[model samples]
Target: MRLKRNPTARYPETGEKRTVSDEKKRGGAFALAQRLGRSLMLPIATLPAAGLAMWHTARLSRRRTTGALMISVALTAFLTGITEPLEYAFAYEAFPLYAVHAILTGTSLALVNALGIKDGFAFSAGGIDYLINLGKSAELSGGYLAGPVLLAGIGLAYGVVYYLLFRFLIVLLGFKTPGRDEDESDLDTFEFAAAAAVAADRSKQKVVHSHRRA
Candidate 1:
């Protein structure tokens, strides 16, 4: 009684029934995004997050609040390889950036491979995993540490690239990233109101204490 043009599947977002064929037909950037799946981003462990944070600072020199928050996130990623926070920040909202990120990730993998760099196996690719893979008994400097060092070196370069590209694209196209959106402004206004209320309360308490003293 029923037929399918393509394999019937639930949409990744809404759980509605659809076909890959139908998605492909829609075409353009969204299709490409769906094809891309998730970013295979590396050093989300450090550089990428740091790049994003630096971009925020680059725009507003005195505003270091976003920078500090991102640095804390970078530390989490660097130590444990928890990258979701940074990845989700722009992935859904900006397809072009996401595409660039995926390409950069692929390039990093290829470079490491072309250099005959041995990808280490462990719980993750973070600093903790890097150190753990080096073996707890190993010395500070040795042949065993070579691969990780190279990987980290490459990561540093990638981070610089990320910072430049992200800064340029975000500014040029006005793509919202972190502290660049209205949502942040709204939140800032709410915080100001809350702080003002607290200050007024404190002032009232001081006045009451003075009257009591009188």
Candidate 2:
């Protein structure tokens, strides 16, 4: 996300709240720190999902369970680092739910910090490798206390809030959740498609021109 500089919020003599240059520097530093955190979380959190998947699919001998669980877990971990998915998930929801997500996300971060299972992954807890790393570290961290708490808290937070918000949104706002149907915005999809088409056309034309010149 682009950080906006509000001159009104800045020190007047400095002629910037956060000057473009200063903001760029800060952004760079934040990005680097985020990457480091993701690197650390990578090996700390993988085993639970693996074990659960194995148990659930034990009779089937299907690796799909493990693979799917791994991918889902990884994505969730990555979202903790990069929050656009989380942000977008609730962007259309009512204020209370959005507040809950924001508070919960921040609290989750704090809890993770408090557990001493800090993620130094390049990405947030929003990806597969990070979760795998998290699982590994969790294994070494004396898993009984911290492990159960993390798993339960995460599941409860996600399940309760998601179900309640989804119910409220669909029943009240008439918005669609995963299983439901409702009016959807075509503008974003159309614009993206149009942009891609334009880009492709331009690229093809450039290639044609280059060939003709050659």
Candidate 3:
């Protein structure tokens, strides 16, 4: 009679007895999916906010260029919720534009606070505080009138300051603010591809090692 052997004892690569575990592989897939989801959500959520900002900026336009820039900044802020990017965009033209934007943002916030206007939804750091405070104070002040007045004040301040200061800053300084961010760099898709390839190679090596040990 021939001797019989256990079939499960042999590994696929090394032909030795060992067990295989898929847990790590599954975990990696889950992590990757989560990261991708978050990345996509970030840009998606801000687009609406930026779009609304653009509309508001356009409405306040006395001329063309400054209005366009404000709209762009609003869009950028809404989309990324980051003012630095928008600030840096204007840094090259008229150093005073930076000061102008800062003053306008502060003045708008103050007027919003003083008049008690509430923002329906906040998309960026720029105006979110003013709206929130306005909402809270509106609630505390008994009714609708106080909030509307404050909101009007905010609108007025934003329009006037943005118009006057932007014009002055552009005319005088001719752009170029300090600490401004430079234009965005290229995406470099190759780096991501290389990283992925390296990870795949590592995983393959791991799988091979495990089999050999088995």
Candidate 4:
């Protein structure tokens, strides 16, 4: 009896016909997943701090109309890490600003870590846990009061950086961000042409009726 071999088997690296030893190498999916997962750590590390900063800023900057409402909205984002709704509103419309946000978030994490202030929560790095830990136990809280100062600076820096960079990039690259590309004249021209055509048709119809009457 002879042993059978799989014709479809291919080398992982070269995509050539696979031999028995090819099984020693890892599959493409596994390799790609590992690489991509490692790359995600930087962004994931920043989310908690970013959520906290946004929540705190909204809470402190309340107005008569939107004060309480904005605070509640920011709190939800802080606790849940569900920023997609807010992010989607401006991410594509102002991509450079979004990129600055990501950079500032990473900076916030770095500043907190460097200050020897360590804090972690099982759920999320939201205000609830942050406040709870503040009074719970100094040993556990890791003296996170320093966090607010760092976050304040990060928020201010983020605003200035985002504004300046967004303006520069928009002018330099000519990106079609939300308000930059609309042409009201084009629509006005179309409307004018349509109205003129309608008037001409009506006049032609009136001439035909008068001639028939005559």
Q: Which numbered prediction scores highest in lDDT against the true structure?
A: 1
Give, for candidate 3, the lowest lDDT window spanning 10 residues.
34-43
In what order do the candidates fall by lDDT, top score first?
1, 4, 2, 3
Model 1 TM-score relative to the real fold = 0.57
| TM-scores for all predictions | 0.57, 0.38, 0.36, 0.38
Residue pairs with colliding backbones in model 3 are: 9-17, 92-176, 93-175, 94-174, 94-175, 94-176, 115-150, 116-147
Q: Write the residue-wise lDDT of candidate 3 on 29-121 in tens digits.
A: 222222212222122223223223323333222224333444554554444334443344344444455565555455544544454333322
Error of 1 at 175 (Å): 1.0
Query: Compared with the true structure, what per-residue lDDT tens digits does model 4 show for residues 1-214?
Result: 9866433333333332122112243343223222212212222323333323333332122222122322333444455433443343236655765787677656655654444443333223344444443432233223334433333345455545544555566557665432234442335334433543454355446634543442
Clashing pairs for model 1 are none
Return the lDDT, model 1, position 62. Answer: 27
TM-score of predicted structure 3: 0.36
Residues 1-214, model 1: lDDT tens digits: 6755323233443222122223243423223222221111265433554446434733363246556545655665666555555565567656687888888878877675555444332333466656654431122123444455665677777777887777778777787665565556646534533543454355446634543442
lDDT of candidate 1 at residue 33, scale 0 to 100:
24
Q: How many pairs of residues collide in each model?
A: 0, 35, 8, 0
Better of 3 and 4 by lDDT: 4
Summing lDDT over every window of 10 consecutive residues in candidate 1, give the lowest-scoring window: 32-41
